[model samples]
Target chain A: MLSQTRYRMLYLIGLGLGDAEDVTCKGLKIIKNAKRVYLEAYTSILTVGKEALEEFYGRSVILADRDMVEQHSDVILEDAEKEDIAFLVVGDPFGATTHSDLVLRAAERNIKYRVVHNASIMNAVGCCGLQLYNFGETVSIVFWTETWRPNSFYDKISQNRKHKLHTLCLLDIKVKEQTIENMMRGRPIYEPPRFMTVSQAASQLLEIVEDQKDSDKESLAYTAETICVGLARVGTDSQVIKVATLKQMTSLDLGRPLHSFIITGHLHPLEVDMLRQFTDDQSILA
Target chain B: MLSQTRYRMLYLIGLGLGDAEDVTCKGLKIIKNAKRVYLEAYTSILTVGKEALEEFYGRSVILADRDMVEQHSDVILEDAEKEDIAFLVVGDPFGATTHSDLVLRAAERNIKYRVVHNASIMNAVGCCGLQLYNFGETVSIVFWTETWRPNSFYDKISQNRKHKLHTLCLLDIKVKEQTIENMMRGRPIYEPPRFMTVSQAASQLLEIVEDQKDSDKESLAYTAETICVGLARVGTDSQVIKVATLKQMTSLDLGRPLHSFIITGHLHPLEVDMLRQFTDDQSILA
Candidate 1:
């Protein structure tokens, strides 16, 4: 019972949102000692590059794309039979929700694994002074096209409003997403990855509201005058957060990829006090 | 422009869910260099005592009770004008949601502060194998009394169920709470701290249904047969998780103060597969 089992172990470590310093001390120690380290590159993007992480940890990190992680994961789990292999993720190891798949596969194979946890945007959004508990279901806003545009996220936002709960909209990120025609031809042709900014997200949201307007009494969900908060590069020193009306969000520039938008619900006095700090016009609340 | 403002700094550090090792490297570095460190003691509980943390950090930590933190915080924020001071929190600094108050105060007073993030139970609940994104609003289940049993959380769970989302129920903890009569006497007659357990939570939930029953099938939203997962001491080496029917949970014992439970709505195949590992007989599905 003492030492009989194989030492094959996998460490899925979370490098918190901003930079390399965001990685937890326990995670960093393991990264320095592990035989191999893999940085998950598809779900979310870290503001810094792999070189930055390598310089900080004093080790070379292999980048694991979606294909490698979803398809060829056997290679990553193989050598773990004798040593620890660390798979680093940009936020909490469970941040992207899909990370659970990796944990499942590892568990299916009986490979010992431990998750090193860190801050994810889901929790860090509290920086905006919104109570995390007050938020309802979180929805992702995806990029739209001529014929494939979808507005299902609007319904979730509406339902959250009915419950008087805030809604956190996670903007879609397309990394290594293949074009439809290229996929049909079995070619590797890929479109440059696109990140949906808060401005674009607001426009799409408004478009849906416009489409659904029969007499335009504001849909009882959200309107051009409803309050929305836009955040970009959260957790970074240069992070930006601003509050504005839905119409104003279309023209505001918070900057950068990985933008998040929130539609607020009934406001508590403290929440109002906090949001006042980020509102464009101080007279709105005064 | 840079040298004009005072250099007073306050660091609100997150000591992750478990014991001392859960503190992030950035947080630990700040703790080591700070002149005084305060551990917030009321909002949540750490599995370990202050001495354990002090021993691990090679420094002394002052326990900041609710009164000290909420009313007498000026004492903790005092020395920061001339030296660095760290305020440590039991989960992510924002996990309690109320920490934002301190941040607002610091900002209002022109006291520069930074938050060193770590894992909170909200994200760490992903270990139960539910897709974290599918989770709806988190609700707190407080201890009930003869005339004070609140049914608000029931409605929230119902709303989440209607949306086909999982609900993370954060059981309440009573730390340093005093009796109303004793409080009026101007004496701090502290009641021994109480932590709500999964069994007690389940019973109180069922009682609510029984009271509302005219000819009830499952008016409480969750029935005796509803699927429930209970977790104790999450993120620690001795963490325990078990799955059972709501009826079965009333008798099951998962030890320790920090416990969490999930009331599932629609279950994905992956979720069912993952939860199967924790079921006692493995015949719940078969």
Candidate 2:
């Protein structure tokens, strides 16, 4: 049972993508009652602006940038021993591994904490008609360098395909990233990072498959003709889910900064039925 | 742009697992404005009692059972064409594949629809520290019968293992189920069915693994000592997540009707850290 004591702190609140109104009722109650509310902004972005959240909740939200939470967590933990403080996150609190560290810290400090859950993109991708349980080991595809191109994600995708399970590829988002020059000069120089788009990811994946074939690592590897799904702005009013071949998706224009790709392995009848509605051409499924 | 006139016909609203207040702000507005509201009671259950929802919403909710939805969808769809009808589903409207069919039907009839999303157990399972994208092919484990035991789930688990991705097993729910006698006699007879418990599922999985090993089909297989996570009443206030060996979890009582399991495959450093907090023995990872 949760104590009614006002000194208790709640950490890691998942604000479902979209708007402040997306917060669960339990999350809202915690935010309203907390002595201070901090939004962790570096990890992910909410579709709606923070001011919109302030107007809806009628409370000023403190921004908890990466530096404050990562480098200076003591500030948030100081009054948490006596006064209630809440750390907000987009999506489910534990969706990212970093927040789990905060929970462990709270446990070590003997400060009781509660997690307010919300919708996450993890399962939201099921809206495209894939079974949530059938997705195998999700891998992230990061931007490749001219000299340092990694192919571990290719191996992971190959493994998923062997089992005939869906592969959910989380596009990389680089925020507050430091450049090599900044590290060398001991200066806090930051470079504007990029979020990988679905089209770019699909093209890269095709290239990796072709590379494997050329190296004789695997025969009959996936190609641009492979069926895939491109999703943009998931969990929002303007959310779009489209089904296309890898070749088709490579050129398909899906507006937005955050995008994800689904490389399907096997399809159950029900899943195929669901995907059919989202596709413009049925030949892609073939 | 969504047409205002379309808003009058069909509204697909998500009722979060807890109570009526768990519905998003947009959902509440649609529900209040709806001339009639139907609660989908088949796919999932809410933690809060129905009475609590009625008290909070100040409206009586018409329950829509499986029969009503499958056999009498016209009742809901017919009214939607003439009045503002709201269909309330636990979790996001698209969480279940069946709901998408309903929306497609409404679309075929030229009934404009809007879906308001909410947190569902699909992503809620990420609270266990497993990457949402890392999960492969979610499968349902049904209660076994003496002569009709099925071990097809083993294939899916093996597939996940091959890819080193976590597998989320959604235990079978037997709500409003019929008995074998009713089918043979062509009578309206029903028997109270059972919800699969974590212990039962683990026991059956062990049996399958042993059987497969005996047949030499798979020399190596998961056993009672396999690491697993048992979750009960996910998305509820009393939700419990516990990590233990399959042998230990089989005898551990979770104190709930709805239970799910996560069979760990490969663990990342961060995943190991997160699981440490919930494991029965912290040194298991070592």
Candidate 3:
């Protein structure tokens, strides 16, 4: 074994947006040496399961579910202070706000940490031909409830459109969430929340636009006729990108859970040409 | 060897946002197997050099510089009818307009194509604590000339701020560009162009804002006191992210090239906390 400072150290590896081998060269080195490897599960999930990652890395991984992180952070953080620990996250470490919070907590405890970065969905969404710099604020579209429907995203889209910038919509993901009743009862009951699909999000957005029209808002949000791009399984083998109007997208079955949408504002000529190749109907450009 | 199909074929592989290892699992497979590998060189550069990639992948990469792609498309498109040709781009293949043009050209020639996605700077900028969905149009700030200074980006920034959306400012990179004399002479003479630094960009932007303030456009595009995040070597091991006011950033030395700036608009409580950790002076937040 190497000396205290000469041995291995804590490694925060970013499992690329898709699968197990998506791990980079530096990430692979740390994983191979880690005494205890934990996959942070709440932020995101790989297309392949934990078994697939185990086969590729040749190591057993502890599933650090939300409960583990929230309740037992000391377990992961403590070991890192003295010995080598690897806490893995799907996508880059800073991709999610939760991971940033975790890093801050570790820093407060004077734990030395190294972040091994990987491809994230934020930059990966550029596969649609939109200029990364031309993109405006990104927003998440969540499943609206009868009581909890919110239209604030409408203002954001409107603002992006006003400047002719692209808006990347990260669909909502719900993992290991509990219902209000289950929390109050203090039972271990949990409900599986739905991941927002592009189709569902578009339908909701159209309704909100119509509502804005009815309420006489000064600016129009977006119509069913507005051109949008729907992307599914972005970094995987079965990835799909389709460009169409909101009405046209309503009928698109992109397949599977992780889906995202892009509502174009004013498009550069190059952007229009790029989006046209992905669509079945070119009339969206018209 | 895999037999060549009767149909024309084009394989697009994303180089991720930074280095060669940033390639997706699917992308690496295609690049290794393809008959010809062409690197699209104009749009962006990986943080690491091409030689570093050549050493890692164990393959000779042909540079498809702008002149080669624009003036010699036949070289890339010719073998597509008989062999699988891979065109590698920094970031997702479709992240830039030039690659989109190549894809459209392939489609016109009835070529079958597959795009392997990787991360782009678009989504990677989220590491700075800005919400992906809350960003407004991303703009490119170019190196200004005394005779031809343009401030069109000012309008876009102003509009985004009014709506409380973050603006990602992609600094300009000018590689392998020619001078007016060289173009007129029809010779291969070239003039080195400038890559805009974050500090230089901030100073120019402040100048534009001052100019705009004097004009009828009284609305502030961005002020010297406005908070901004300067990011350098984003995806590399030495990546640095700093949050400071424009005035402060103008004087600080970030070191190295390929820098970007983010002019912040609105801040969520969580974003405020995250960015505060990277802020130059805590007193600025107060």
Candidate 4:
């Protein structure tokens, strides 16, 4: 029902976590008829690449990297003044705060825009059989550096545990980030993007737990034997989910980047019923 | 590509919070090709109903009430054993744990199923410009009764506030709930479904705070002057968001049901930038 009479529009489309087919029909319709499509590839990624998306959507999508989106967004908006342009974001359009900035810019420019929502891990983690309502604060697990190791996120998890609520830990992804020195020298050199694996996150989490004492003053909030769930590439056919001890999680093969971890607390019986199937207690691998 | 072998399938499709168009293209395609589609009406509702969904989807949808789903689910899955069936869930399929039980049922019946994810209130609250990641445990504000005024959910919000994390209060919806006498009499009489408005929620919240005081004689958790956000009919064209004090919020008119409130703790500069626009500071009524 879209009119042929073109109106200048900027569509922020959510390409769900899976392949192109995962894009909603309405979102795909807008993409198919879009003047241009830019895939915001920084915050997260799809299981498939641009080629697969192009083949499925039948439109060549331009990759809008961090620099393009954060520094040169005017360029992304330039075409919006003339024709309908699409900014396809992985997961929900507002999953990343940056997208909201884009919407603000469009509003300032008097360019009309619309956001088409899709599933984000913030909600999709319910697939792990954890009660979505039981989840407390969601915290990010960032990659640790030798001198820059920070354990603040673990405190958030501790707070959730205090309330007997589940905690969803979003692993970090550093994409197209410039080296500090390189940035200072006005150089365009960038480090290869790094994504935290579930194993790495588990190891770092254990380290933090070792440092923070628990209520007993002898143990920590989470230990090696604590039950945890590691999810990799959710929303894909090859999606992996494992319920194991924190120690076992370090050895599990989740198969890809874009991983998430869950530190569970008290669970309802129904939850226990659904989650027991994935628990390491029932597996020889433990 | 789906194989055209005409296999019996149970598709747990997510009809996004909006109308029929909110159903993903993938979901719509399955609905079009399926032999039956049942809309689960108890958990939540879309902006449009069966008639509008039928008009937009070009297919008739059977209304699956709570009784049919909880007691007589076999009736829903009966057709699935012979042909493709669609069980349309509002928002994401796994948003409610009850739907997970449905998956368990489908598995028990040896029925194959797939969950097509869509935007749920869990993630759609991002529209209010609050960083979804920064939100802590979500709480539900239920209708208070003379003898059954349990305020346990308030404690959860208090815990989240202790961590300086935002709390998303999911206003309660009572659908087809029967009175104790009617249920005991085996009568079909039921109380009309009730959705707690933001105003009602704020007033109750303030009363609880007045009753629960901290060790130092200070009011626990939130006060009447505490800032809060009220969102009504989210994901619809008429979605309204207002920011005001808890006392100020108790009188604001946000129109119909399906309202959610945010008990904000700490505000990031960017979140403040976006939310300030909705703040009552600029209101002439204030």
For all the predictions, what are the DockQ values? Answer: 0.52, 0.51, 0.40, 0.53
Candidate 3 segments whose C-alpha is farther than 4 A from its true place: A1-10, A82-84, A96-98, A179-181, A210-219, B1-8, B96-98, B212-218
lDDT of 1 by residue, B219-265 (tens): 45767777888988877766888888877888989988788888888
lDDT of 4 by residue, B139-210 (tens): 888889988998888777777777778898888888889999999999999898888999999999988876
TM-score of 1: 0.94
Rank order by TM-score, top first? 1, 2, 4, 3
A112, model 1: CA deviation in Å? Answer: 2.3
What DockQ class does candidate 1 belong to?
Answer: medium
lDDT tens readout by residue for model 3, A32-139 = 788899999876777898999899889999999887787778877876777778999887776643366666667677776666666667766767777666777777
Q: How does the DockQ of candidate 2 come out?
A: 0.51
lDDT of 1 at A194: 85
What does the lDDT read for residue A249 in candidate 3?
Answer: 85
**CAPRI-style class, candidate 3:** acceptable
List per-prediction Cα lDDT, in the order shown: 0.83, 0.76, 0.76, 0.81
* lDDT score for residue A125 of model 4: 82
